[model samples]
Target: MWQDFGDYILSEAGDDPVKIAEIGVGKFDKISEILSEKKNITVLKTDIHPKDSTVIKDDVTNPNLELYKDVDIIYSIRPPSELQPHLINLAEKINSQLIIKPLTNEDLNTGRVKMKLKNYKKASFYILR
Candidate 1:
């Protein structure tokens, strides 16, 4: 899904300096490490229970946009269903893109976020501006 996410972002925004906000980073350093391969990207990793180095420790359903304005991409791996619309709203606000990897069998239609999926499955939902 991360690879798919990288492809989606590149296809939409290319190699520009992208501001990426990722939720549920938890203790996985690999995400940041892999994304670091992209030289022009800035990653802000977040979680409900963040360590000291985590940035923007806020809930995804109501993100602190004042701290996260102008982001170029919003990424999440199976965030709570209620937070999905907020992700879409943030992307729309910043004119960015959204990449979400949902758990198997999870539904993508909440009807709150209006999006046209480039590709979608029970396991993933990929969107672009």
Candidate 2:
């Protein structure tokens, strides 16, 4: 799923260098590492409580716009339900595409996010264009 998601976002990126942000990245660097491999993409990892030095300290509920300026894509994997709207809000504010991969069978409460269910590989996620 991470490979497929990375491919999808890379496909959307075309040949231009796209700035992508992974919110609430947690301890997983699989997708981030993969995306960063591509010369046409730049990936930023953010979390409120960063587990490592690679992740920047930032809260999803109240994101730092300076850190996210010109971000082309914002995605969160298994983000807590409470912060769903904040992710959407930040994406909306930045006018970037938003992708939320909540845990399977989890509910998403994103007010006015206008997301559509996207089936990429075996991963099922929501996307706001």
Lowest summed lDDT window (length 10), candidate 1: 115-124
RMSD of each: 3.1, 1.1
| Shift in Å, residue 49, candidate 1 | 1.6
Give the Å shift of residue 108 in candidate 1: 1.7
**lDDT agreement with native, every candidate:** 0.67, 0.87
> Model 2 TM-score?
0.94
Where model 2 places Cα greater than 4 Å from the true spot, the runs are none
Candidate 1 local accuracy as lDDT? 0.67
Most TM-score-accurate candidate = 2
- Model 2 Cα shift for residue 109 (angstroms): 0.9
